[model samples]
Target chain A: MDRLSEVSASLVGGFEYNCIIFFCTLVMAVPLGLVITFGSMSRFKPLKWVSKTFVWIIRGTPLMLQLFVVLYAPGLIFDIPIKSRMTAVLIAFVINYAAYFSEIYRGGIESIPKGQYEAGQVLGLTKPQVFFKVVLFQVIKRVIPAMGNEIITLVKDTSLARIIGVTEIIMCAERFTKQGLIWPLFSTGLFFLAFCGILTLLFGYIEKKLDYYKG
Target chain B: MSILEVNNIHKSFGKTKVLQGVDFTMERGEVLVILGSSGSGKTTLLRCLNFLETADKGKIFVDGRLIFDADNKQKPSRAEIRERQLNFGLVFQSFNLFPQYSALENVTLAPKLLAKERADFKRNKAAIYDEIEKNAIALLDDVGLKDKMNNYPCELSGGQQQRVSIARAMAQDPKILFFDEPTSALDPELTGEVLKIIRSLAAEHKTMVIVTHEIEFARNVADKIVFMSEGVIVEQGAPEEVIDHPKQERTRAFLNKLSK
Candidate 1:
């Protein structure tokens, strides 16, 4: 009983940290991802190559490696510690997820027909208006399924913060394992499964709402 | 004065030439039908008149304004060019309605976006909605799709989709409408329906430029017919003179081939 109470109390701050990371990633990654998509599609050679290379490198490496390097690299290279472990984890999450989200965005935008663009031009719409009014909604509709997969994956990837000593849900569960109380570690699965189930329902609702755009 | 003029317009794609020094002119309120074989630049010539495809070397004048003049080749200011573009509405071979919008919304999009009149967004919305409902229904009635206003383009058939496209263009109320092979994607029955609607529109004295292979439709509806070959206007006159009594050997051979 004492072990359960201790585990729960210790997790309060980590739960808050987890929520912060979740919200920040959603707010930052969507727009950052769009910008990265533009970079990948840029007519200029250098910008396209640089953006694609960054995405490839981030996607190739494991998130655990990224968390460690991000948390320690600033301190090691510049001799000025980043000071906040939470900030390092947040930065690493934003950068890693933005790359994945950008590829999804690019795929969605490219799937639309070239005729739609020509039709917009014929109607005397400027390039920006065409993107916002015509292309944006279609792209959003096409990408929702792919985006849902990434977001559900993101919920699990948040556990990678344990490597940086951020004390997220899994880390709180690990401490109980050291004390010979396996129940708390198993209890953590309840939190993860429940969260994932809610996310699945949320994404299913979104897919239903976008049903009008079915090809 | 000629309302629109094209002189010596030429266009080439990498290695294949599309329009080689094409020339023609149209009086105000004149309906000219363009007829030609498939790669003879009939569609390319129509696109050039609206500046949809820039000509490599030519002069095009709309209402005596030098919209494009290759010798001095000064593209007009953006506002000037938009003003000239407002004079015509173009309908494509494929129905290019924005699939995201409903049929009514598709019809009202251009006017709402341009916002040339109406005081505020509310007034504009009301006016546009009214305009779309009224003319959209009328256009659909004319083209025979009066019941499908709420449906998206994807929900309609190829023929019904083309009618919706015609209605969408008519909603803009431009002085001249251009149709590029509008019935090529439809079956004979659907083609008959669209052609019948176009004939009624012609009765209303709507000035138009149509590039089509439907010889009988052109003969019945076109005030003048221009026969093109190898990117140039080989012959042009009243439909009877050009289609029935051709002077050019190529025009006669082309007509005979289609007749067979």
Candidate 2:
């Protein structure tokens, strides 16, 4: 029982790191992703091309490799290192997840029928009003499922931050495995499973709430 | 002076010319019904008049004020275009109500948004909102949709959805209302309720431009009829002069086909 308490105490500290990374990445990525979506869908050719190319490169590459690059590249390429490990993890994770989220947003926005825009315009709604008042809620309703999938993945992906020496729950469990104690590592799975389960319930609730939006 | 004057309107998509030098004039309180087979530019003409599509070449005057001048070297600003668009309202073939909002919300959304631009909005917020809500409920009731005002678009039938869209259009009280094949998307049994509301609007002497395939309805409701073929107006006159005694061969062929 004493050993179990010790293991639980250390895991809790590591889990705090995971939660911080998870929330910070989400808080920064959600709005950043919307900005990127608008950039990709812009009518200006150069801006659209840049945003598309950036998303393609980030999505094509692996997240683990991005972590290494973000932590090391400024020092290697520019001779000025990213000082904080947490900042590096956050920078890489936010950009990577934002690229994925932007594509989901693009799909949601594009799926709206042209008739909606014409309807809004004929009602004398300016372009921005049409987007905010007419289109935004429908897009939110459509993208929720896809966004939920990414969010669940983000919970697990937070473990990858350990590669940059920013210790998370899984890495803390790994230290116990190295000492020939395996039960704590197995216990780590409970944390992830419970987190994902709660998220599943959350996403299901959101989808039901938006059920009236059939578009 | 004519309430609306569209002169020499021309539009094309890539190489396909949809509207070529179409011209017409509408008096206040006149109902102008446009008839044409599919791909004959009737819908495109309506779209151009509503500013959904900018004409390649033309001039449009509303209330004797120039609204669209394609020949002008500089394009109109977004605000300018929006200001001009306020003069007309369009009901689409498909009832494009915002699915997320209830019927009452859909009818009131545009007016409330426009109301925000008023100088007295902040000081008179409660009164302004109450007035907008009252107007929306009245408009919905006028279209026989009083009971369905709180229902979402998906909860309503196709006819109910169309009625809500008509109420949405009427909320703005436009100078000229345009319908682009409004009932074409509805079930036949459901068409009567919608047509009845339109006939009542006609009886009220509301100026309207309608593009529809309902020959009998057009004959009964139109003050003037314009038959278009191949991107141009072939004939336009009073209903009896144009529908029963068409001068152009194209108009005659169209009426004969409809009769058969």
Specify the highest-lDDT model's number: 2
Q: What is the lDDT of residue B52 in candidate 1?
A: 79
The residue-by-residue lDDT of candidate 2 on B12-99, one tens digit each, is 9999999999999999999999999999999999999998898999999998999999999697798787789999999999989999
Which residue pairs show collisions in model 1? none
Query: What is the C-alpha lDDT profile of model 1 across B121-213, one tens digit per residue?
Result: 664677666765686677777777777888888898878888888887887787788999999988877888788778888898888899999
Model 2: fnat (fraction of native contacts): 0.85
Candidate 1 wrong stretches, greater than 4 Å: A8-13, A76-80, B70-81, B116-141
**TM-score, one value per model:** 0.91, 0.99
Predicted complex 1: CAPRI docking category: medium
Residue-level error in angstroms, candidate 2, position B73: 3.2
Tens-digit lDDT track of model 2 for A110-193:
999999999999999999999999999999999999999999999999999999998899889999988899999889889999
Worst 10 residues of 2 chain B by lDDT: B73-82
